[model samples]
Target: MSMDFKIENVLSMNGGQTDSSYARNSCYQEISLRILQPYLEESIGQMKMVPCGRFCIADLGCAAGPNTLHVAQIICRAVQKKYKALGIGMPDLQVFFSDLPCNDFNLLFQSLPLSVPPDGRLQACHYFAAGVAGSFHNRLFPRSSLHFIHSSFSLHWLSRVPPEVENQMSSSWNGDRVYISKEGRVEVAEAYLRQFQEDLKSFLRARAEEVVEGGWMFLFFSGRAGACPRQQGGSGAVGDILELAFKDMVCEGVIERATRDSFNLPFFSPSALEVRELVEEDGSFLVKKMEFLSMDTEMKIQSDVDFGRMVAKQFRAILEVLIASYFGEHVVESLFQRFAERASQNASVLYNSLRQGGGILAIIERACTP
Candidate 1:
């Protein structure tokens, strides 16, 4: 299916090198590892009794860069350690890193470190990077081939901005272009839910084909509180601060209200129940674990200054891509001016506000089916 939106560009923007933010923000990777470790252990335990054969692990929605591979390396090392303890021979393993066609796979491939030896002989770790453009739900990997499937900080992105929001049929947007209208709010929430449902189905189907019958799948994502989107906070405190910044831009006429409204970022954070329903509906996977934490745990905002800077950097990156993609290259200066003006005041207060907004994480396993 053709994507109505430029998902690859947005993903690139989201994945830009924000070393401080990623390092400081433990929620995405740290918490994800916590949930993933057990499954890895269990999968490795099962692999120990089996005959030496090829083992496959896939990182879906792996952005075109080192960050994706960085995680893969960690998992590989963990699995290797497990086998070492069990005194079982290490299985030949392959790591498949996947993302969209527009992603910089060449850059990712070029940056991979040279192969090292796990034994006296060369390590049998094979790296393959492929682009699975459209929706990841459709086709990700071959059926019954994946031993483990891991995705973190990626699933929340909707396949497309809800059609209702695009048509302006919903009242979510205020005259100021901020999403203040109740109808607009509901519309955005519904759109996200619908997109998530479709995406989840595709994800399950694809994984069902790729993963071995008893293999494991772990997914960690940002989720909202409560059943409805309105019940939750913004995209952490930083996102709220950005919204405030956008408001100022609108008031000063630095950016058109419609321009802001036309910009769509579709992210959904489902509650535990919502996630359970989504997984169970597929009847192919079982919910092994699920956890929801506030923004503090998810994003790891230790201080107001750090929080402010993190939010600022993310907005700056997002704005850079949005300007290049939607408006033309020339409008970046004006956009930066608007961002600067909005972020200059009461940084501490804005940071505190963002800390109040948190996110969620989840883990699942493929149930052995007859």
Candidate 2:
């Protein structure tokens, strides 16, 4: 770990607030899954050739929420239906829901479905859900253990911010900026890029060891459709624009100027090409499908209601913990309140940027020959 690194227990999502559970804001994730439903079915289809006596599936980065089980159920159903169609006895199923250690495992465990109906062609499937506490940047299971791995709305988060950018003592500090954006200087962007490269390699290497040959991995996360993620503003890439909210608070005296300068999110938005290049070089997994999924941004906003608040809550559920760890909970709430106001006023910019934002869906298979 870098001496300047501040990633760990400090960063976590809001633990399912009454109004802002991950479930509510995860519509983008849900839709991302649905869009890749066909590819998911295809990945499950691989079991026909690979022996699956005990199928193990993992939903990596599964925050505690109403939507986490939905992914697990999909995996269970797919595996069950595949086995049933072949007139073979289904294998025992183990589903791992993984996330950072501070995540609300209690909430996630509490929300699991008591049962799941058959999917595709099975009668019924029984799945045992295990809450895995660890960062996906490191290994969490035995080698060749996982069969189908799925992660959504995650993985864009680097295990830590770039040491160069955060270590102010060094000449590589990102200055006052907290994330990659137009505001970030060249070195700042370079620091983020370096961190992303290192973290991504670790993640791919770790997953490569755990997944058996012919096992499939499905990853869905926000990404820039453009070639350069460093420049900011990609489809579904509203991450950078959120900095405006921070600026608003700073100017309004709601937060200290130094506070905003020190805060930097560990998030990184990778372009499809970046991921492709790394996976290709990893020599562990073969890319089966990689494409961008568009989000639904055409919803008609009621003139009376604040549309910005609606969107801010979604991000708040995912980001509040990280922000609160540094600035405290009170500050977190105040910041978002101001964010909601600004976001609503700039809704037109958001809507226009929607076309530039989209989710990357990648289906990869552990090389059978490897």
Candidate 3:
């Protein structure tokens, strides 16, 4: 409902293929992509009704870089492979990579693969990729134009800080905190919950208009399983880590305490029931699969990674864009420095919190009519 939260205001990921950047920190995104790969293949492969012509696919909130297009290619290849198996010429394909305007499109295009020589492959020369700069909270494509829509690790963000929480005089203001903690005010928590519901519904409604009847969408983001919004006992959750660092900064006179109190992150983590309710209420999507899984449970522990640094890279990539925009560029360096230090200080606790972190994977189909 509120458009004050412009996409350009947020920060983009660490650009380029640098080893210490988001390219390396984004392992969890890869893991999520794999989890949804089979569904992409099977659903698109088996679609008997998709019109035989240019097929449109959009990856909403596709942050800049190789990985974004890389995942889309995986889905694209699966469809082409299926068409080849059926002894038919492949349809023309156009992919829309939509994200915030601040996203590094130049860097992403630089990373795009030039081309695979046409060895008489199924979809050779049939695929075209382009970046569409905008928020997924609004319509990004023409009506009934998309065959598949995919978004990962993006939807939990609210469009803006709720006005109730933003009002200086309101009791709901998230003072001295950047998020709704276990000890947060009830009104603060309720404002956040209300904002998420509104934003998610708007997203689904817009996508419903853009996607064709029976078209599929796969959504993966951080979500909790139980009835509560906050995951109990996970004190090392990124929100907690950030808050801890903020507290330390306050005590040392680096940043004024009121500054931290006034700044609440424009984000929330919904429970499974909450996600389901929003989808059902939208009335234009049929819920197919709703799963809440632990992010680290599926991982095969890699011996090489320094766990604390790995986690810090991801948090910085995600929050840096907004933090730098609101807090100032000078604070960015020291903030993440402190974030990594805090994470390393309690390695066991931090790793356990990550292991216990919740992720949601939901597959929904657009109804022909609302």
Lowest lDDT 10-residue stretch of candidate 3: 297-306
How large is the C-alpha RMSD of every model relative to the true structure? 4.5, 3.4, 3.3
What lDDT score is found at residue 14 in candidate 3?
68
Tens-digit per-residue lDDT, 1-370, candidate 1: 1145565445544332454223233333455455455655555455423445666788776754545666777677766766677777777667877765655566567767746566534363334334455457567666777777778767876665555565555553323323312234575566667777887788788777777766777676767556666444444333444566666667787667777767655566667677778778888876666666554534556664555555555555534554456655665656555444555455665554445544455556667777
lDDT of 3: 0.74
> What does candidate 3 score in Cα RMSD to the true structure?
3.3
Which pairs clash in model 2?
234-356, 235-356, 235-357, 235-358, 236-357, 236-358
Q: What is the per-residue lDDT of model 3 for residues 203-318, given as tens digits with 9 covering 90 to 100?
A: 99899899888888888877776676545333216777788888888898887877777677777777768888889888898888887766664444443235556667777877
Once fitted onto the true fold, the runs of candidate 2 whose alpha carbons sit more than 4 angstroms away are: 1-5, 47-51, 115-123, 167-172, 234-241
- Residue 98 in model 1: shift from native, Å? 1.1
- Please report the candidate that would top TM-score against the real structure: 2
Q: How far out, in Å, is residue 207 in model 2? A: 1.3
lDDT of 2 by residue, 31-70 (tens): 5567667767777877544455678899988887767776
Q: Which stretches of candidate 1 lie over 4 Å from their true place?
A: 1-10, 14-49, 64-66, 85-87, 116-121, 124-134, 171-184, 234-239, 251-254, 294-307, 340-359
Q: How many residue pairs clash in each candidate?
A: 14, 6, 2
